[model samples]
Target: MKQGTIHNKDRFLNKVADRLNRKRITEEVQLPTWSKQPQYEVFDGLSQDELLDQFVLQCDAIHTNVIVTEADKLNDDFDKVIQDMGGGSIVHWDDPRFESFGLDSALKKQQEQGTDVHCWNYQLGEANIKKAEQANIGITFSDMTLTESGTVVLFSDKGKGRSVSLLPQRYVAIIPKSTLVPRMTQAAEKIHEIAKEQGRMPSCINFISGPSNSADIELRLVVGVHGPVQATYIVVDDK
Candidate 1:
């Protein structure tokens, strides 16, 4: 029996599978990109430092303990925050800053101490979906920020995943001052620059304004509708 020649029974199964595949793809295409539903808050002041201060204040107001520290202090602060949040897990990319920021070692220790520290260097959407579906906190990095609108832009490149931003019920993004731009328009231009240099555009560029929110029927406002209940911007101190 030549393997290249399909039997009648196999052909019938293949046709059924093909129809199923088309139906699955059709459902995916019909699914919506979720509406514009975020409780956006623009912190006052213009500088990165100012925005960071306001972010800390907002976190404090929401009763999430603030953990501001030096690069070396990330471990202690991170551990405390994760523990306070009920100790789920932390995930990272292949980026070298995990060590530079001193999070990799601390998180590993936490995992060994009965916490869950899961690391995957690829497929961010799947990773995020997993962590979001199970973990309490999902940690990742960001490419830039918009100080004017108080927006964080997580560039979905080789390592940084967009799901790392969207899926997690609680998202903590590590962004330094060097990547802070002033506006959303600039974010698109930066994307264009990267596209021109890389010969193609990346698959996703996330501009997160704030946690998910909505004003539905009767104009009643509600928060945390589709995404995380909390989104905190942890600005690592360089000094």
Candidate 2:
């Protein structure tokens, strides 16, 4: 123990902490008042429909396409988003959404409706790797994360993999607003905690704050050198 340490400090400290943790403190701690918002604001207190509108406006500011709608509207929004992005036909798919959500019927219908949203569904063993590779635009929900800088961390288990965020020309992510926080660093710390508890490292830990970009060219900047040229984040209000 350190010089200032007490022998029974763990239990005592916990008891003190419990006493200090009142309902008001908990509520205020979760949703803090920002001193000010930047010209580009981080959203709060918006409904799902409102959030969708806000998300779309921000996307337009950066020339990124926005798509929203649960599995029910996936076919429409999914196809519309791709077409707006200037992509032709669904040349491929990553298939993560289908197995996790069984969105095959919806996805297949879009394919038939000239979405060109491809899905072989050949049952080529127990892997969905190839489907994601040829996809024009991959869609999935994020595991709840940052609001500032528009970052979303899609844990590989439930949502799309890190590759889907990178390999495609454009990427779209759906974030439930209830999970939003102020910035990127907070998301990192939370992921670290989840990582420690799991006793195994996540296969991929992407800290995406915006579109894929680089300025390492010949004295000029460029985007999507190694990944998507553009990125879009859709925040949905579940409350």
Candidate 3:
């Protein structure tokens, strides 16, 4: 047994030595010169308007409801979404994009109407986390929307907690038309560029395609197992 172990050890070390001595390939890999880059080809024919339309359509197909509203009507639309979902406690990110539409006033109105609404605290204290976990709805400002996959990208950081999208029974994402990209690759590239410029990437970048779901146990379909069961995307025509 000792002899066999020694032989096997010798064989492993010899293989390691061979691998170490091998020349490393350093040739610059040329990316495919396809005009649409193969991956983004699906977005080639989609116009800006069509991109938004396709985003809504694809979102609907994935069991996610999409609502389109003009910039001026964003406050009304927010009320409509919360009302449609039966007005409940909500926890949302502290993004300036929402503030552009006077979110504070809208939130105050909702609170006055008996809806428990709170913004995520950048401090990330335990009490705030508990509050978010108990909330019925989670609202977030999407970094970008991918038309092809109906995905909403969210960069999590100090003021943006991943729990805001995961702990609640329902999720509401506010997406601006200007942030709509035709493909996921473009979205990823944008993130990469931001990281390069910012010197650091967000701790967690969530690409939510739809509500959390699984069909594993007994091959039975289930929703909200790990996150929100119902997801809504409010796409506003605001640059």
Candidate 4:
């Protein structure tokens, strides 16, 4: 990707500093310490198993199916999810973790059985969006999970199209145990660390909680109004 250039960045900052009756400060500012940190207190001492239980309960409230399985059995569980969703065309991200999590075999098997399987291809560009639109299901690995909200965080890139999750009729997120956190507070901190380490940020970061729903029509709740009608999370015990 081409790096963006800032026009007169120093001039802009200098003007702001001048208005504030101070010179431009080049030093890093220290973050203020808060007196009470209640955000960290929720699920602070919970074990991973406890967090998983909470996550499952939250998912149920949101109408999302949660499947807990071992990494070794991910292939079978994934296949079952596909079958349950009424297998047809499927699209997934171009992420190698699918193979690491034992899902590649399932995807390959589906293809061999004449099921349409499309992996997001950067080279194909807009064609990838078309495939996602035509797909019955779209799959992706969660970059970070918020157990409090039953949310799956996705960092979109060239190979990981946002359409893979939004355009499909159904969405599937593969969540590793280690990726689960107490809530968005922890997820935001991790994302800040990633941006600092990488010296750049992803084009898009999506925090999806359950299926697409809206209450716009006569104040009645409607599902799948703007995105996937059905969503599922397969949590792998890979920690």
Candidate 5:
């Protein structure tokens, strides 16, 4: 990842340092020690399977479906999920993991069968958004998942449009077991580590839990007002 340059950054920093009556320090700052840390105590030292169980329970409360499958059967399971969701026009992020997980052939087969399948293309620009808006289902691999909130974190970029998740009628997240964490605290720490190792962070990070829900119109609950009406998570037991 390339670091983006900010114009007059040095001048702005120097002015801030002068106001603080100190020179600009370039050394890394140490994090503060919080005396009472309760966030980590929740679901502490749980096994991966235990975390996943908690995640599924939370998903049920939020009206999202969860499917568990093995790596060898992921292609079949994924295909079934799509078919169960009505198997119409589909849009997905242009990610290589689809090929690694043996879904490329499945998607290609769907295309051959006259099902409209669109992969987010950076070169196509707004054309990708238009396709996503008209798509019946949008699929993407979850970068990280928080068990406590049943939230899937998406690291969006050029080939991974946010519209693919927000504009579709239904949203599906493919969660590799290894990516599941206990809570958002762990997710934030992992993101911070990435920012430290790489020069730049992802362009967008979406924390989606379930289908869009609100109760603002006369206190009446509404689903799919702003985004997908249905959500599903396929958790693969992969290394």
Candidate 6:
């Protein structure tokens, strides 16, 4: 064995051996039980109605626009959002949920009417990234909406790429009432459960509260500094 390699191995082994008998280290470490409900009573007695109300209030506080629409009339509402923003190119996640909601068909119809629509597919490779970057609007589905923080959680999957939310000038999320959770703790627990069931977590899990803003430059509070300047959340009352 080379003298340098042997010395490195001995140093590593000595470091490990020194830590084994350290009296200052405690073996019984207690970590916060993230899966359990927090002891704080802020959300304890809140009803579903109260939660939704709080959610809207918090969203407004964070400069996020919330639109409530009936589940059946989502298509119309979606079209209204697009029209209000004017006809332009849109990029969206290619999830089955979007397909089931006929969003794909609606986009295709818009495309035939002279608007550009791009569905993100990994097969398209880097082209999808470019399309998302240049799109006027990007739409995605929220995995969970935390009522307390008015946060939307997005987990990247095969059909849902992170760029669909991060790359556009305007980002839109279609959230179902059923996906609403109480707070961040519950949301984390749900993500842990998903990981256990799937045997792995997604590569990226984004928690988005509102439009991106930063006060770093002269503390002037610039919006869309690094991300979409405008974000809209459409909550479908599927109940």
RMSD of each: 11.1, 10.4, 8.2, 1.6, 2.0, 6.1
* TM-score on alpha carbons, each prediction: 0.68, 0.57, 0.84, 0.94, 0.92, 0.84
Q: Tens digits of per-residue lDDT for model 3 on 18-110?
A: 789964444788868666457767777777798988888888777899989988888998888988887789998877766786667788898
Better model by lDDT, 2 or 3?
Answer: 3
lDDT of each model, Cα atoms only?
0.64, 0.57, 0.84, 0.94, 0.93, 0.84
lDDT of 2 by residue, 128-194 (tens): 4454566666565666555444556666532334555656567767665666655555567778888
Local lDDT at 151 for model 1: 68
Tens digits of per-residue lDDT for model 6 on 111-222? Answer: 8999889888988889999999999899998989999888999998777899988988998999887887788878888889988887778879999988887988788887
- Of the candidates shown, which would achieve the greatest lDDT relative to the real structure? 4
Candidate 6: regions farther than 4 A off: 1-40
Clashing pairs in 6: none
- Candidate 2: Cα lDDT at 144: 54
Against the true structure, candidate 2 has what lDDT? 0.57
| Candidates, ranked, lDDT | 4, 5, 3, 6, 1, 2
Lowest lDDT sum, 10 consecutive residues, model 2, at 119-128
Tens-place lDDT digits, model 1, residues 128-185: 5586566666777667766555567776656665666666567676766566655665
- Candidate 1 all-Cα RMSD: 11.1
Error of 1 at 138 (Å): 1.0
User: How close to the true structure is residue 166 of candidate 6, measured as C-alpha lDDT?
Assistant: 90
* Candidate 5 lDDT tens digits, 114-187: 99999999999989999999999999999999999999999999889999999999999999999999999999
Of the two candidates 1 and 3, the one with more favorable TM-score, higher being better, is: 3
Which candidate model has the greater lDDT, 2 or 4?
Answer: 4
- RMSD after Cα superposition, model 4: 1.6
